[model samples]
Target: MRKNYLLGMALMASLSFYSCDKEVIYVQDGNGVESVADGAQIITLQVENGGDGLATRAGRPLYSAEAKQTIENVKLWICDNTGKVVYVKEISNWNTDGSTVYTTGGHGRQTTIELKDMDKLAAGSYKVYAVGYSNSSDYVLTDVTNVAEDGNFSENMVLSLSNTVGEEIFAGQMEFTVETGKGFKKPIVLNRQVAGAFAYVKDIPFMEGAKYLKLVASAQNQSLVLGNFNSVDLAGNGSGNDANVKYVVNGENGKSGSETYEISSIDLNEWFTAIKDENGDNLIDAGDNWKNPYSSEGHPTFQKGSAFGGEFVIPFAHVDGKQTLTLQLTNAGGNVLRSWKVNLRSSDEQLDQTITCWNSVSTDWSTEVTDESANIYSLVRNHLYGIGTRMNDDPGEGTDPEPNPSDPDDQPESLNNKQELVLKVNDNWEVIHGMELD
Candidate 1:
């Protein structure tokens, strides 16, 4: 037996800036008007995958793999012709798994949903909408019932870094006119609301016996704020000094040997200047680019506003072009072992390059033939400040200056200083010879 449930209460909800499709199809009666003898209507609420809702084939799934999830419930809304929400419904009960909920019969086996007390709906043009989600608690609810202005809806659907479930949100809307007697079968095609980027380490030989590697987003926080459906507006008041707000790759347990980390929400600013004026001189110099450990014998957190922190930085948000991500290899004792501060972007590029500085097959950094003409190691050594060595044409080449020249031995320059690392490459570039830090 089919049960008929009704929530006769009127729904007063807030409006959002998101728009819906304007075209509507009405199945007319002999009188050319829709008529529902019992003042009830049935609609097919389609549950499909949610990325860029493109079906590769005619009957393929709707969402892309990166944004696909099992949708558990849907929040439906009916708005008046004036763009005012008139009714709302929350539907959760369904028959099959979300992946198989949509079938070929045009009617869902056990997924039928109803809009009750249709007769109470005033005669006017209207639009119907549905939004589906898996985890309800992950999102901040927006009570838009009282706001009178247009739909600049609050960040009601923002997904945080902790929200492993609500990462995929889907919604669909259609416009239709409501008359005294009619409803027809309608389908809602849900679209996904997020974008993603990924990172990984390459050439393990240089990083042997290493147990930790972290990728830190200079200004981004652990939580990602989805301001717009497909856009991420990084949180925090641009106060990049907040330690807890900055997002760092927290690998499972402690370290991940070359595992890829997904960074979904990030804001890239070309002119981002960190407060590196260590001398209070109000100007940036090599002295300020040093990565400072939180405390003695502690791991270094890339300095708050330094230029580059030895981690791969991909400006996915920047339109100019893709930038290269640099890599640093360190020892178990927190000493800089090797720095491959080169233009290696993708893993394929890193693996295919002819440079023989560090390789996996050798399993030993020393075995790498630095004498190879194309070897990056030789190029790095060419810049070292030997007693009578001629400075390479590269003016950027030289010996690393002491980070704190006063206590040069105890506070040696960190590898985060590109110029210093290059100048002292022979010492800092190899674990067998580099000056180990305290």
Candidate 2:
């Protein structure tokens, strides 16, 4: 009788649905509820009749089944213990067999969702909710489960150096080693994304002597490592190296030193140009001072008694632009070797100057300068005069040649017109045998 009544009602509704444009109303408790308008219908969702429940693991697949009736759009979401939605998926079509599987008409289908990287998901309980909506109504269903038994472990570690700029030391190649406890497996090297973050898959086997491991981080083309973790001794022994290994932090121990220099009154621009040696050849080349007209056979040679000294020329064009200039030096290991700051003062008149060092051979290792006026600078090594320059002169426009008592090729003492600035170690201005510029 119930079947007959349902069949009779379906027949009456189908017939009364008459005009294709006429809406089909649903009456509840004899109160006629407005029928859903054309293109309007409620969507409902629930676990599929024969579908399996949701299952997940750390490294396992995420599985879930859902049923949707022509109600509306269907969406599924997975949320963490904190109620934060971690995953969302949309279902567009849900159809099977000839008969509509969904309780609502026009909707029919069952679907299984898949998820990965479950191990990255935090260990805790989570919830999955399915929402269905159509023009007329909506439906929601939810399920909750514990994720602790997902069998995936977290393997993350943070690495840092006492020095803030340590990671930037070796042209960006920082190497480090890992140690796992005995019986623990070595973790899989995943990725090093941040300055101090490294991710690994827990997997390496930990041997007895693996209590501590040493790793050397080095830069390419460099002979020495930028940094090393030598005292990272593990406290426990384990079968597989877990990502949660504790590190025995220690103080940073490495090579350190410094360099210093003194500067006389000079134009800020000229002072900076004097030190700009971009090629790092240890000599001031033609390009060093764009306005200076001079060329050398090659990079300047710096050593005791070498004609090509390390003294550099100051261009007259740059003066009174700024005040103080400082140069910073770093060793191959990125350690601050030294920094020199020079105070610049306005000169009464453009004066010729000379800077001298007492010891010649030891200058290269100890003497280096940078132009704080500009970031222009260079390193002088093993040469008596690392840089030097003379006023640009026409090939043959100078006065009468010098009548030297010995060599005619040499200009006369009075007519020796070459105006050159010479930088020497421990030499005084009076001992300077160069011509005076007007």
Q: Which candidate leads in TM-score?
A: 1
lDDT for every model? 0.26, 0.18
Report the Cα lDDT for candidate 2: 0.18
TM-score, each model? Answer: 0.37, 0.16
Model 1, backbone clash pairs (residues 3+ apart or across chains), number:
12
lDDT of 2 at 205: 18
RMSD each, Å: 23.4, 34.2
Q: Write the per-residue lDDT of candidate 2 for residues 1-438, one digit (tens) a residue.
A: 000000000000000000000001110111113232332211112212110001111110101000011222344344555556665445443223311233222112333232333422333454333332222211111121111232221111112222211111000011112122111111111110101100000111112112111111111010111111111111111101223221111111222332212211112122123334455544332232422111231211111111110111111111123321232233333343332322111220102222121122342213222222221111111001111121111112233111122322111111012222112110100011111111
Give me the displacement of residue 379 in model 2, in angstroms. Answer: 90
Model 1 lDDT per residue over 1-438, tens place: 001111100000000000010001111121223334454565544442211111111111111011123445556566676666666656563224421332232112224455565424655776655555454434433432232333433322323333321133344455555556654543343333222111111112213344333222112222222221211111111111222111111111112244323222111111122323345443332333433222232322122232211211111111112211123343445454444322211221112323222222332222222121111212111011110011111111122221222321122133332321111111100101111111
